[model samples]
Target: MTGPLITDWSAVSPYGIGRAAFEEGFRSGRTTSVPLENEDWLVGERADTEACLVPGFVIKEVLGKKGTRAMDRVTGLVVTTVGRLLDTTGGPLPSEDPDEDTALVLGTTHGSHKSMVDITRDTLTDEKPYYINTAHIPNAIGNASAGMCAIWYGLKGPNATIAAGRNSGIATLNYGRRLLATGRARTVLCGAAEEYTTDRSWLEWHTRGADETGTVLGEGCAMVQLRAPAADGRGDDDALAEVLGVSSGITGPDGVAAGLETVVGNALRRAGIGREEVWAVSASAPAGEAGRQELKALDALFGDLDPLTLGRPGQIGDTGAATSAFQVVATLTAAQDSARAAGRVAVLTSVDRDGALGCALLRMR
Candidate 1:
């Protein structure tokens, strides 16, 4: 079956808001990093990791006051990014009519970690158990951002959220693909959002060692409009790339090489293509051990082919749940640019901390 098409996309990252800034950063291979403050309290020493944060982000400017009073940063990012997608597409997904056939499916790792922690801490520290403001309760759940978008944007179709750790982008795209294939929705907004909070940085440092001085913790949101190819067999000028297929599997770190090879092979087989045909790969090979294992796997699979790769997480830092989505955005940017001839065919491969190896194949049309 023909897969969905990525008709439009928008992103809000540390580099800046909107897709233009993100694409420029990817094209130039630039890193947006700044020293994070308050790390001494958490790490007991000067924090090693730099941070990439969305500067000057104000939810009141985007959504006004009443509704955003309780909104979390993750929700704000998704809402703003999707708002941009709507603007770029000229409101293709009807916002007035609640019955319009549009879906919102998002992916994230520890989606509401910060928000949840805040409310819990409040509940405990307060003198009275009920002293905690109940308004903060809604945004503490993993699906809060997606649910908030559905309500705020009037998207009345399937509103779902997945907590697939770092493999969320792959899961979200495949979920949208299924929705299109089954005729469940006319269009789907598939994306992921993550925020860089002090708690998150501390958690990353304690658990994953992701906050080491050289490590950069990046935060952002990316969303793409996905739908079946047009009936006329032609897509709009904004069409970035055609989704071919997605493959995902689970394995331990020791088995990542073997699992990745199998996942890549399966993705290619599903796309009815071969290794040589894949001109480039947008890899999630962040720095350190994960990057090494991923490179070893790629080398073993394609030998000397050495497929052109794009967007190492070090450039954007460790984006967690939003990392893969950013990779997709980067790949689409390269594919649509005239200079990258080999960008015609590309694959997105990621290995999440949960031992999930995911791959997605795409071709510029």
Candidate 2:
């Protein structure tokens, strides 16, 4: 270990949007998700829309027309969520220090869905492609969101994005922690962000993982400000969560059990802990059989401890790449506030298509 890793970190989730909301959702023991109204239609599958969606929060109305046009909805969420995290971290508190060595690593499966859809529609509808939003199209690149975040904060440091399906978020966190331990950066603002609305149906069809299993169209952001212990004025004892170790493995579809086991085993070994050490497990609960199988695997891992789901989050739908990231963030927030939370570690796990499994073990405060 080059130095003491992240000693303190907070979370931001859609359950309530802030710390207070996170508390209410966790305290009530119910994570509630709302349904979508004006959904986008899936192009080749069943024609009509059938999943829950997030409310349409007019982007221009909030970010203003000028600042708004530079990004699509997916990108907007990353910028806005990361911005809020930075604000809570330093700007909101006079005691907080602005860390100049912060790095931004984003995890995304698809970026700029809204703009991509717009461009496709423009191309088919008009004889001339002049009507397409060329500016927005250019910004649709996967690295666009991560780059915008770095530029916004004037952070002249390592900025990268990882996309490995449902495990992208966890992989991104692993990347950040490795960088921190190697002395590549002082701190890292990291997590996953993906926009999956019914309105953006084509995106859903191409990347959708078993829709009948209730993959609610989810689109939003989850970001964490991770800093090295002893950075500026932050104390090592003040660590909110510790990054012990991380691992990822590829599995064939038939190797679901083996895939998950391979990653989880590697992560635990890296952390130097056993399955019993994990207090809570944040799962990627989709729906029906897939969701059931996921839970059974967890039951085998920690037989006694109950692995709970964020009630509303599941109902609203699986957040694709952001699935495990949101679960880890939301669970950490809850564990931090509850007095009964005694375990020093939490296990983050996820399984994506094509036999890919990712896992990370985080040591807690």
- Top candidate on TM-score is 1
What is the lDDT, from 0 to 100, of the residue 39 in candidate 1? Answer: 35
Local accuracy by lDDT, each model: 0.78, 0.63
Q: Across residues 32-106, which tens digit of lDDT does each residue of candidate 2 receive?
A: 445333334323333224543334444565345655565666666676677667663212122233346778888
lDDT of each residue in 271-333, candidate 1, tens digit only: 898777777777787656666667778778765776676747436678889988888888777
Q: What is the lDDT of candidate 2?
A: 0.63
Query: Which prediction has the highest lDDT against the true structure?
Result: 1
Per-residue lDDT, model 1, residue 134, is 86
In candidate 1, which residue pairs get closer than 3 Å at backbone N, Cα or C atoms, i.e. clash? 48-213, 49-213
Total clashing pairs for each candidate: 2, 13
